[model samples]
Target chain A: MSAPLRVAVDRDACCGSGNCVRTAPEVFDQDDADGLVVLRQAEPPESEYDAVREAAYNCPAAAIEVTEP
Target chain B: MSDTLATNVPTYPFGNAGLEPLLPDLGADGVGRVQLPTGQQAWLFTRHEHLRELLRSADFSSDFTRPGFPLIRPIPEDMPRRPDGSLIRMDPPEHTKFRRMLTPEFMIKHIRTLEPLIRQTVVVALESMRAGGQPADLVEHFALPVPSMVICHLLGVPYADHDYFQERSRILLAWSSPPEQVRDAIEEMRDYLTRLIAARRDEPGEDLISRLAAERVATGEMTEEELVGLSVLLLIAGHETTSNMIGLSTLVLLKHPEQLRQLRERPELIDDTVEELLRYLTIVRTGLTRVAVTDTEVGGHRIAAGEGVIALLSAANRDADVFPDGEEFDLHRGSHQHMAFGFGIHQCIGQPLARAELRIALSEMITRLPGLALAVAPDDVRYRDAVVFGVQRLPVTW
Candidate 1:
C-alpha cells in the first residue's frame, strides 16, 4: 500500500477562505471560532491523497502544506 | 500628492501612476491617513507585507455597518445596511459559512469543466463583434457581453436581460452616480434577483441559484432573503469586474504593441501574461476597505478601534519589495502574487472563474484579431469614472 498523505496548516497565514476544507474535508476543516483551518487528520488515508494535494496547491493563502511521511 | 489623497480622492485609472511614487508620502512606516470620497479621513496601507497581514487580521472587520468602515461614496442615511450575509462585507464564521457553501462551485478543477462553455461564449461574442462591422466598440461587442452571458448562464438569469442588468451594473458601480440613482439600481437588482430565485425554487436548473435553492435554502441552512442577496452579489460582481478587466487590459495591450506582439508569439506566456496584466492593472481602484474592530498595530502604526483602513491593492501589487521592477508590465515575469482579488477570507470567491474567463478571452482576442488596432486615438478613448477602473469604450479596428 502507498504511504498516506500528511497535512499541516500554518494558521497564521490562513486567510480563512476555506478552500482546503472544501477540497479535503476529511483532512481539513475550518475552526468554528474564526474560520481558520482545523487539521482533522494529519495523515489521511491513501484514497484522499489526491484531494489533500489539491488543497495544498490551491490554498489561496498558501497556508496548507502536504508531504508523504 | 498627499494633499490630493487626503482631500480629494483622485480619479480612477491611476494607470501607470502605479502607487510607487506616493509611498514616501503615505508614510515612512508604510501606514498613514488619507481621505475618502465620503469626506472622511481613513488610514491607508501601502506595503505588501502590511496589506497581507491586515487583510488576515481578525481585529479588522469588513462589516459595512461598523463605525469607520471606509465608504467609496456616500449612501443615504435612510437606507438599510447591506444584508448580513453579503460576501463582500462579512467576517469570520458568518463569511466562512456562506463561502463554504459556494466554494465547490468555483474550485479551479470545477471551473475548468466549464471551459467549453466559456470558450463557446467567447466565440459567439467575437462573431457578434464581427457582425457589428469594423471600427466597432470592443466594450459593447466583446468585453461586456462575454462576461454578462457567462454570468447570466451561471446564475440562471436570462442572457436577454444583459442590457437591463449591464445598465444597472454601470450605474451602481459608478463613482459619481447620484445616491438616489445608486439606490434605485440596487433596488432593481434585488427585485430582479428575488424573482429569479423564486422561479428557481419552483423549477430548478443546473445553475448556481438552482443548486443553492435545492441544497442550502431548502435545508434551512440559508434563508431565501439571504439567497436573493447573494444572487445579487454574484450577478453584479461576476460581470462588472471581469468585463472591466477585459476592456481595460485590451486597451493596455493595444497601447503597448510590443507587449501585445510578445504575447501573440508565445502562447505559453498567456498564463503569466494574464497574471501580469492583473497585477499591473489592479482594476479595483477603490482599494479594499475595512474598520478596526479593536485596537491594532499595522506596520508599526497603532490604529485605534473604529478607525477606517484602506489597503491600497494597486500600491501593494506594485511594491518593489515583492515584485521587482514592479512598475513595468512584463508578461514573462511569471509571478502571480497579486492583490488584484483582494485577500483573506473575503478574497474573491469567484476568482477561479474570473481567471479562466480572462485567459480564454484575451487569448482568443489576439488569435482572432491579429490586426486588432485602436480605432480611436489613445487620448480620445473614454475611461469610466467608476469604483472599478476600466475603459468606457474601446473602439477597435483591424
Candidate 2:
C-alpha cells in the first residue's frame, strides 16, 4: 500500500498560471483575491498523489512541493 | 538627473541586433535604466532572477492606468478602460477575481478536449495549402487561421469574422500603428463583442462566451462592459500570440532542417521542442510592462516609487545563469523555465491552448509534408516590426 502524501505551495513564488489547480483540483486551488496558489489539502488522500506530483512538476513557478512517500 | 539617463532602448530587429545589444553584457549585473518606445526611461530588468523577483512582488503593479506604467506607446489619460479592464492590466484582487472565472477555460485538461477539433482544423488547413500548390504562404494558409478559428469558435464569435478581428489585432500590436487607429480598432472590437455577448445572453451555447454569460453575467458577478472587455482580450490574445509563435517557430525549424529532421524522426519530442522553441524565440517583445508602487530593490538597484519597469522577457529567457548555454536552440534541453509567457499573476493565461496548437500544428506539418522547404532566401524572408515577433509571410514549398 502507498504511504500518505503531503502537499505545499509557496504562494510567494506562485505565478498564477493555474497549472496546479487544473492538474490536481482536489489538492490545489487559486486564491480568490490574488490567484496565487492555495493548498486545498495539506495531506490529500493517497488517490491524489499522482496528480499532486504532476502539478508540482508542471507548475511554471516551481511553487508546488510534495514530500514523503 | 535627466542628463544622466542612458539612450532610449530600441525594440526592433528581434535577433541579436534588438534585445542582445540592449541587455547588459554577461557577468555584469543585468539591471539598468533604458528608454522605451514612448520616449520615457525606466529600469529594464534583463536577468532571470531579477525579473522573477520583481514580477512576484505586489509592490510592482501591472495596472496600465498607473501613472508610471511603461506603455510602449502613450494612451490618453482619458482613454477608457474596459469596465473591469484586462486581467494583465490589473493588480491582485481584481485581476484574481476575473482570472479565477476564466481559469477553467484555459486549463490543460479542458484545452485537451478541444485537441481533436484543433487537429481537424490543422488537417483542413494543410489540405488547402497543398491544393494551393507549392510556394504558398504558410502564414495565410495555416498559422493564422488555425488559432484564429479556434479562438473564434471558443468565444462563439463567428469564424467568418476572422478577417475583421485579425486585421484589428494586427493594427493593435503594430508599434507603428497610430494611437488613433489603435483606439478605433479597440472601439470596433468592443462593439462587436458587446453585440455578441447580448445575443449569447438569450440563447447561450457551450462555448466560453456563453459559459461566461451564464456563470458571471447573469449572476451579476461580471458586468456587460467587463464581459465585452474580457472577450476582446481573449479574442486578440488567443489568436495573435499563438499565431505568431506558430509562424516564427516554423520559420526557425525550416531554417534548421537538421533539427526539423530530428523532430520528424522523434515525434515524442514535439512537446519539448515547442517549449524550447518558445524559450528560444521569446517573441512578443514589448508587452511585459509594470510600475513600482513603492520603492524597491531589484538586482541591488534601488528603484524609486512610481518608476516603470520593463522585463525584457527574451533577454531573461536566455540568461545563461538560468538556462545554461541559453543562446543555443537545443530542443532536448527540456527546460520549461523560460519567460516566453511572462510570469507571476499576469502570465499568459492562454498558454495551454497555445501549446496544444503549436505541438499539433508543427509536428503534423513536418510529418505530413516531408518535402516542406522555404521558397525564399533565408535573409529575404520579412519579419514583422510589431510587438509580437513573426514572419510577415512564409512562402513555403514541398
- Against the true structure, whose TM-score is highest? 2
Candidate 2 overall lDDT versus native: 0.80
Which parts of model 1 have CA positions greater than 4 angstroms off? A1-7, A10-62, A65-69, B1-24
* Model 1 chain B poorest 10 in a row by lDDT: B12-21
- Candidate 2 pairs with clashing backbones: none
Q: Which regions of candidate 2 are displaced past 4 Å?
A: A1-6, A10-69, B1-27, B76-78, B81-83
Candidate 1 overall Cα lDDT vs. reference? 0.80
Compared with the true structure, model 2 gives a TM-score of 0.88
Instruction: Please give the DockQ score of every candidate, comma-separated.
Output: 0.14, 0.24
Write candidate 1's Cα lDDT for B159-273 as tens digits. Answer: 9888788889889988678998999998898888888888998999989999999989999999988898898889989999999899988988887889889889888888888
TM-score (0 to 1) of chain B for each candidate: 0.93, 0.94
Candidate 1 residue-wise lDDT at B110? 68
All candidates' TM-scores?
A: 0.85, 0.88
